[model samples]
Target: MTALGPEGHRKRLRERFLRSGLEGFHDHEVLELLLTFAIPRRDVKPAARALLERFQSLSAVLDATVQELTQVDGVGPHAALLLTLLPRLLERYHQDRWRTVTTLGSTRDAVRYLQGHLEAERKEIFCILALNSQNGLIAVERIQEGTVNRTAVFPRLVVEAALRHRATAVILAHNHPSGEPEPSAADRQLTRKLRRLLGDLDIAVHDHIILAGPRYYSFAERGEMD
Candidate 1:
């Protein structure tokens, strides 16, 4: 038989993909298409397969750190950079969508919006839900990013940010990649510390939420904060 040659092979595959969409494609095929956008004129099938083998799944590959991604065969600094940007782009999209909620009407609404924006993260990130005199959301600021087990959030920093935003109340939130929303002893201690510190400034610490997988635990709801 005869080789179809690179150009003809790529053209045929591209045509088929355009017609069929990604429904029947393998993981490597999907990666190949993504690579085509960055490393055009190159055969990206091998690179795609390599990435899948290394990362296990497409979502894992996309979520991997740049350094980890670069370790995959055929994934150099350029490919890693492109892969890393995808999450940031998605985060921006989520942030835009979250801004549509003008007010914090209920604890559930606040948790739903925040979990959508941050639950899938591998590391812990502390975010402040700043509110106005009327309980309207003013801004969401990411204060710190820490290891999977702990996120070091300074109460003073949170208080200062609220003061700057003219916030009358604030809801503190952070993710637990382990997906257990139950507040730990340390978590309880931190909430009490923040509440005590904020009380001096007359700024209310409304709640401290632990986001774990699809579930969330609210300190205020449990009567822990009251």
Candidate 2:
């Protein structure tokens, strides 16, 4: 039997991937195969290893911004774009799947969706899911990103976003980089402020969800909502 050359080795890798999946594949191997698409006729193993070293994980490599990805040695514009876009494309697929399976109101569905949207973020991010009368998504407006303070995330701004989207209801959400879903005092205050302001406008405030790494907290589930 002839020893496999570099091209033959790459072919076998692709074939093995297509036959099965990434069930038992190493992180660098997965990344190596992925990089093959963006970079032609070059060994991607080193590039993949470098990416893992810099980002610390395959998920982080895919989630990194283009600027961050390009900082790795051998990662060019095409490779950077490819790395960042793969996770984003998967995100859109999950969102589209969530839309069919569940609306914005279901705490279960909302949690699943929000996890994908905000779980990877390293800093605080607040977004509103605007729902129509049927409880379907109308628009998802980013309220702010930073410390969750009343000043940074104004109640008026949330209501205006909902109004602009012509939404009948809204679900508030924010991430806690500390990975604890427990709402801070400012989070509680902001939720109450938005609730009252949105109430005045006759729009229902459904829930406030806090995405904290793998775990999540729902105000409605905790009976914190009035």
Q: Write the per-residue lDDT of candidate 2 for residues 1-226, one digit (tens) a residue.
A: 6336656657867987999988778999998888888888887888999999999987778878999989999899999998877766766776666666436658987888877777666668889999988898887778888863322677878888999999999999988876688988888988888898999989998999998777899999999997
TM-scores of all candidate predictions against the true structure? 0.71, 0.77
Using lDDT as the measure, the top candidate is 2
Off-target runs (Cα >4 Å) in candidate 1 are 1-33, 41-45, 112-122, 177-180, 199-202, 212-215, 220-226
Could you give candidate 1's per-residue lDDT for residues 1-226 as a string of tens digits? 4337555556666777889888787777777777776776777778888898888888778888889988888788888888878877876776677768888888998897787668668899888899987889998888889998888888778888888888889999999877688888888888888888888888898888888867899988898886
Candidate achieving the largest TM-score: 2
lDDT of the candidates, in the order given = 0.82, 0.83
What is the Å distance of residue 135 in model 2 from its true position? 2.6
TM-score of candidate 1 relative to the true fold? 0.71
